[model samples]
Target: MIESTAPLLSVRDLTVAFDTQNGTRQVLHGISFDVMAGETVAIVGESGSGKSTAATSIIKLLAGTGRITGGSITLDGEELTHLSEREMERVRGRAIGYVPQDPMSNLNPVWSIGFQVEEAVRANGLAQGRAAVRARAIEVLQQAGLADAAKRLRQFPHQFSGGMRQRALIGIGLAADPRLLIADEPTSALDVTVQRVILDHMASLTRDRGTSMLLITHDLGLAAERAERLIVMQNGSIVESGPSKEILQNPQHPYTKRLVAAAPSVASQRIQAVVEDRGVETLEDLAAIPPTVRVAGLTKDYRIRQGGFRSEMFRAVDDVSFEIPRGKTLALVGESGSGKSTVAKMVLKLEDPTSGTIEIDGMDVSGFSRAQSFGLRRRMQPVFQDPYGSLDPLRNLENTIAEPLEIHGVGDRASRRERVRELLDQVSLPQDLATRYPSELSGGQRQRVAIARALALKPDIVVLDEAVSALDVLVQAQILKLLADLQTELGLTYLFITHDLAVVRVSSDLVCVMERGRIVEQGTVDETFANPKQEYTSRLLEAIPGASIPLGGL
Candidate 1:
């Protein structure tokens, strides 16, 4: 436990607001907290809970319309609220480091990784001259767990994978070794294993340097395991705050209890137990049933330039095969570039396979004509990972959902409008939200909208490519439950693609573990999770965050 002496950072009665077109709206009210030197504190909550807003407020990095309405932020007994913008700029990299939630948004795509890191190093006066800055940049990136930092420095943001980009952002944040580090959903976009690696590195680095960390995340299990102290926020206010273990074991607040109960890591254990005890049917049972979708030795290849005039064929999906029975889900689990999405694309006919046949409901889609492929789209639709990107910013909910129906010529304007309303209701969204734009909805709501749009054409096979990855645990549970209910009612087949093992445990009836473009292990969810045959599969299972903690005990 951290000694309650003069704290490293303190906040009291913090209130924040944003200037909307309708006028000023208070987002946070009278929130207070403290971070002791060398202590790790986590703020856990769902979207719109003001966790990120509070952290951003401390650094004065709030968006243009946002401002601290009432607050006192003190660091090292120095008042920070009254600091000028220029003074705050100096204090930012030197005194406080910030790692934003989305690396793509925070990182400049046009700049090289080395250039960004050096800019921070030079701006904070941590290093002088071109050679020193470059050396320091490599040192910091290597310290942040990036391999071959010196060589990778010249690469652009697009050239790096999601985990690599996040590591680069962390490198930039810790370049100057600030006294305090504010990490906002730093590992939310990564695979479970990659998330663990980055988080463990951050934890060790901060402890070694005696730098305090304010981790903002929506995963309660992660907070419980990693943070000594936990602050629970809901609807823009703190609902509870105390020792993380204490709060997890005996949550006093109802909201905190709900959050713990909805945590995917904890819920996954319960699912595993239920399936283990009840004994689910084997993969042979699935084989007996006629498959709605089947891929026989599916493979995809891309031509890549090797030299001046030489090219080589790169196999993206190598001999991957799986089957999904009618109304059942077959999850393709792997890290980034592990061919999960590529297999999904092939299954959906978005990408043509180099070899093997894809049969949907006994029809060979590989030989599908242009018109036939167009018709096949109505029976198979895709719900992508990023809801915001999948949704059209200019289109409202009604129009977005109705577009699919219009494209398929399923109905007239009036009928499509009615179908849109039904889809909204089916997904448990408000009727009034039909008029709202994509930006107006929360992450969960936008995902629900995406699901509604995918179901607009009454597709038989809905390919969900990391559909619930970006949502909070509570919202994720709701969406999964909604998907299960819809599957039961509509008899929909799902080709779910995700890197989250916990999600695979809960949502998938069968699991296909992919590694480097090949399915290493495939079986019923119970069989595969209980006794993984491949070392890679075992590593993936072990990498699930908070897996060491017992859900039943909590």
Candidate 2:
């Protein structure tokens, strides 16, 4: 792909710092790299590793207290560091297009998609007159792979799916046909299939346009697949830089190695229940206990009004049935609005199933009285998707874990304190973190505390609804491993819900694919993934980033 030794963009001795109440905290530690012409390069690392910080520094759009303390950023031999705000503005969309991380937040809610596209096009002076601008907007969206571009132009961001919103952003980014495109975690929030579609279209457009891309992500699998060269950042410093193949197959840095290891593989880290005999917790009796949780013909319906005083029924979950074995994980895998979460709510007894039976340990929960319902709560607990939203910010780690115990009146003050300590230990958190609030801990720590809270009552079953979806790649791996270890020791059954099929491979023993409020396929992970019976399941597996990359041998 390299046509010449000359580079398109270059940075030298780049350093970034943020001014806070505490003091100046340097982020990028004199990092330097080059993006050659027509080349797709990637910088990858976990949160706080400064991968995003470095990317933002190039455009001088660092948020809040972030500022470039020292660096030499240039484009086509033109120095960008000394440019004024006006000059930088002119260089931004016309010369360097940017696709930000969060589409929902970045896009304006009140404005239509066409309005946003027109704004970008008009701002760059790409086309004249309202008619010309409308035509150009449609053309860009069509290029971004959105069908019926003219009809959907009036649609708002809320009306668009995650994939569509991302494509809209891509259309806006490529509106002016900038020489270089900076894509920051473009598909992080999308479904696997949707992500594959967006990536494929973006790759095709960039290649056809001969545009260089600076792809930023926390996923090595995606970076390996989309980018030719790799720059691994850690703690604000560059750890390794080389070809993507060299970086993945023979990473030298420990952090890079961990990232590579964290990359989800089709045939790796098999999903199995690790039943460790701790003497106190015996798995021998679990076999005799009928499936910890069972469901038959589960369905949920809602009402939507058409016009006047008339409304029709909308089925959210349609005849979804599955069984979760003792101490094993069964993941409900699907994209957004696939009824996976609705099924979870039904299982939790939060909603009444219209026509189905949900049995816990061979006992139907349909006619459970108030007291039985309370006891059922003790037997089953839930770990939600967003740990930050789920956890109480005002509460300390100690109290957060022990809050469940306090609510159920399981133990006295002294016992609860000791139990909190034990839970911290179980989750591999420090003893001193008992005094720290959620804000003081990292995302991974907060999630661990949530797990500890879920396990406080020693629940027989735990329902995780998109639990690991919000975490980075490496942190997600660590959490998965932690869940496996806890399952082995505590012998706790798990109901894992996620949109990521790749995640399902390493985390669940059995897998069920959901699409449009129905179960399309269900089987063991190995059998189903090896040969998916349904088209939806096949697309999901095929959509996994780097699915074509041969990483198993490594």
Candidate 3:
């Protein structure tokens, strides 16, 4: 049971604000909470809800714009809000560990994984011998369930996969044996299989070590699966606080009710099929004429070396074939290094297939020249998974949204601006936000801008690559509904590439399960989900947390 005595971490009237041009914006508005020893507490919120700011304030790592406006933060009964920078550095890695949402950005690109992990340990005054540090690093990595932990120590950040990178970050966080671990959206980027594995490992590790955790996430199901207690934040204040089971089963606040309801849980989808009937059984008999996009005998190979300079060809995607119908979505689901993104790249003409034929609108793009490729691009648009990266940081929203129209010379200046307004309205973004840059927008707003940009050319098909995965559950539902409406309005086809089966059920009309560079299962959304043939597909379905839990009655 969680201790009712003095908590491991305590916050009283905690407030933070950012000095923006719009004026000082209060983020965390006098929020209060206590995290008990050996307990998992989740700070659940939507975009701009101050979840991340609260976590950073504990470690004195709130970015430049944000400052602690009021109240106090106590770690093990010691005040942290007034700690000096130098003193806070000593407390950072030792007293409180932080795992940000994006490991790729947090981790140094140039440094070796082992060196970074060792450096973190050294920062905590654990300056042992290099051998001892390396041994401890490997032990932590193993504890995090990273495969071939010792051998992977020599690997660069790029060499490790997405899930592995997250694991590596966790290892680094635990290197100093911190009393408190703050994981900010830990499972946002992982697939169902890998996400469940990592989360389970983290729960077990924290419980065994008696470490307190403050998990910040938008995923309600994730909170139910991992957190013992839940704190729901909206705007900037705590809307509700209770045990996880209580919050999940009997959400009191309206925001919490909406959040729980908007979760497109796989279990809920499992019990009730999205489609009334199983229309298509095989790719061959999907539609009348042909598939919207078809790939047959596709292959891609990369060279990798072993101990010496001797190299071997690695087949990332080997003879893969699939079909997607018009005005429908086909989600290619898989974990990292499962050749999902590689296939997306090949489809987008970003990478050339070593041996294969890609048919779009029954036209083979295999040997397309620059002119031909440009034509194909005009008919197809891509909505990237990461909206921030997809857009230009320097350019304002108008320019970003108008880029495709400018490239294609589709309209004049005023016409393009008018088109941009229409697209923005479709995505339910404010027209005033058009002048803002990508950096100025929140994650949801940025994603909506990306969607507006994708729809600028009014392409026949749009590739939504994990488009809604990064969003809050409410925002995700909004985006999903927007996609569905657009599909109906424009008769647009979508290739929704995501590892999230929740997204698959919500956005996809058909499903294609991928594993280790191969398509394990392919059928209509109703057919495959209702009766998953592949064990991998079944496992993916099963890994979805809180799948069996119903939404609290609103």
lDDT of 1 by residue, 1-554 (tens): 95558889999999999999999999999999999999999999998899999999999989889999898999998899999999898889789999999999888999998899999889989888899989999998999888898999999999898889998888888888899999999999899889988999999989889999999999776887789999999988999999988888788888888887787761363232122354567888888989999899998999999879999989999998888999788999998889999999888888899999999988889989989999999999999999989999999999999998888888799999999999999999989999999998988999999999999999999999999989998899899988988887788898999999988888889899999999999999888888999999999988887767654323
Which stretches of candidate 2 lie above 4 Å from their native place? 1-4, 271-289, 306-311, 369-371, 552-554
**Model 2 C-alpha lDDT per residue in residues 460-500, reported as the tens digit of each score:** 89999989887898888889989988888888899999998
Instruction: Tell me the lDDT of model 1 at 269.
Output: 39
The lowest-lDDT stretch of 10 consecutive residues in candidate 2 is 278-287
**lDDT for position 274 in model 1:** 20
lDDT of 3 by residue, 100-136 (tens): 8888888899998888877876677766888888887
For TM-score, candidate 1 versus 2, the one ahead is: 1
The lDDT leader among the candidates is: 1
Each prediction's TM-score against the native?
0.95, 0.93, 0.92
Alpha-carbon shift of residue 116 in model 2 (angstroms)? 2.7
Q: Provide the overall lDDT of each model, using Cα atoms, as 2-decimal numbers.
A: 0.89, 0.88, 0.85
For this target, which candidate reaches the highest TM-score against the unseen true structure? Answer: 1
Runs in model 3 deviating more than 4 A are: 1-4, 21-23, 267-290, 305-309
What is the Å distance of residue 167 in model 3 from its true position? Answer: 1.8
